[model samples]
Target: MSEKLRDQLVGAWKLHSYVEIPVDGSEPFYPMGEKPMGIIMYTPDGYMSAQLMKPGRAPFAVNDFYEGTLEEYKAAGSTYIAYTGPFKVNEQNRTLTHSMFISLFPNWMGQTQPRVVSIEGDVLTLGTASPISSKGKTVNSKLVWHRAQPE
Candidate 1:
């Protein structure tokens, strides 16, 4: 059954869409614009890393990573999401947990977050298990991914 499956996820996935649905009756918000770009990879040895970003982000005036101006830094920071660490799958419950040891979002650092997983065809959808605070509003995040094809 799908719930008792995990091997299907051991590969690279490319982001298709990301939407944050607010519980307060407001319209859904796109954290990285309508068409975001990202990649998520789950290694065979229980490790995973995800990096997402708004497409067409402007390059900083300075080429250095740590030398960008305040505005540049803020723009880059707000437009991207990233995290990496160990991952565990609960085949019985049909859920996956991402233990964030390195996260761009401060609140997620050293945290383990659960995702409700659904894979249909070549698409994989992972969603937050519960509503979480984001930009001062309660929202649930849903991120869709497509299995990356071998080059």
Candidate 2:
């Protein structure tokens, strides 16, 4: 991978939109709702982390994380997606693969998934290379992100 492209990606990005287009000619679904909130960060050293959540999710009845009821826990889990690990860039194909060391979704743990990547100005678009099961159907996800301003 070219160092220049990698350098361009080493920062935080804010989620702008996320949509899943089903292969079976179904309507696109929004996993995190229309106005989802998320942050994805890539480090120059190759580490990366992503956290996405549905906006306005209800708070658990209990304040403590472990004290939530089963329903609350389920709601929390179902409305969020997170993972972190090392990332690799394929310069030839203009792709990026995230090798998950940890993930909120257990099935993704230890798996490496490639995403087709494109950058236009400050926006970065990532599209799934393969269909993934979401909400009971196989679909390809397309996510757009804007570069985050430093805090």
Candidate 3:
């Protein structure tokens, strides 16, 4: 991978959009709701983390994280996604892979997913190369992010 691309990815990006296009030609779905919010950060040391969620999610009735009601737990689980791991860039193919070391979705733990990547100025676009099962449908996920500006 070129150092330039690596350098470009080593920063924080705020999610602008996240859409899942089904393979069966159905309407696209927004897993994190219409106006989702997220942040992904890549470090120079090859570490990365991403946190995404639906906006305006209700708080659990109980303040304890592990003592929420079943409905509250389900709501929280269905509305959020988070993972942290190491990342690798394949500059030759303009692709990037994130190997999950930790993930809220247990199934994704230890899985390595590849994404087709492109950068234009401050926008970073990532598309899943393979369809992933979501909400009982196979879909390709596309996410757009904007580079975070220094405060």
Candidate 4:
């Protein structure tokens, strides 16, 4: 039986992989490096949160959150992504839009981003609706997620 897209999306999904495809067709890359870890969750109430991190980040010499050196802070910022906010689904085309109430990257804090979404079995694949500059290149982000199983 096929369920509505919204219904299918109301749950937690673990990150399987993430890739960025350059519009110029130069090359696709993974910003978080190999084996990135993350989770994206959607609630029936239309709220959502996503967090992704690069694997094996170096431990900060200082234990305090605010005590990291510039290099350490830069590494942390470049390796982690997080945002939480409300999301809306377009019933006409079954597309998704996420509005960031709070984001790790300040520029996205007030942005509403569109996502091209599809689901196959337990897999959910999300792609950027439009190209965006990333690492000095224009690219579309593709994130594949698998439905989380309860432990």
Global CA lDDT of candidate 2, please?
0.92
Question: For residues 1-151, could you state the per-residue lDDT of candidate 4 as single tens digits?
Answer: 5578899999999999999999999989999986889999999999999999999999899899999999999999999999999999987789999999999999998999999999999999999999999999999999999999999
Best by TM-score: 4
Pairwise TM-score winner, candidates 2 and 4: 4
TM-score of candidate 1 to 2 decimals: 0.94
Predicted candidate 1 versus true structure: per-residue lDDT over 24-86, tens digit per residue: 989999888899999999998989999999999999998899899999999999999999999
Candidates sorted by TM-score, best first: 4, 2, 3, 1
lDDT of each: 0.91, 0.92, 0.93, 0.95
Ranking by lDDT: 4, 3, 2, 1
> Over the full model, what C-alpha lDDT does candidate 3 score relative to the true structure?
0.93
How many clashing residue pairs appear in each of the predictions shown? 0, 0, 0, 0
**TM-score to native of every candidate shown:** 0.94, 0.96, 0.95, 0.97
Error of 4 at 148 (Å): 0.8
Model 2: residues with Cα > 4 Å off, grouped in runs: 1-3
TM-score of 2: 0.96
Instruction: List clashing residue pairs in candidate 4.
Output: none
For model 3, residues 1-151, the per-residue Cα lDDT tens digits are: 3357778899999999999999999999999987889999999999999999999999988789989999998999999999999999877666799999999999999999998888999999989989999999999999999999988
Question: What lDDT score goes with residue 144 in model 3?
Answer: 96
Residue-level lDDT tens digits of model 2 in 1-151: 3355677788999999999999999999899999999999999899999999999999988789988999998999999999999999877666799999999999999999998888888999988999999999999999999999977
Candidate 4's error at 132, in angstroms? Answer: 0.5
lDDT: worst 10-residue window of model 4: 1-10
lDDT of 4: 0.95
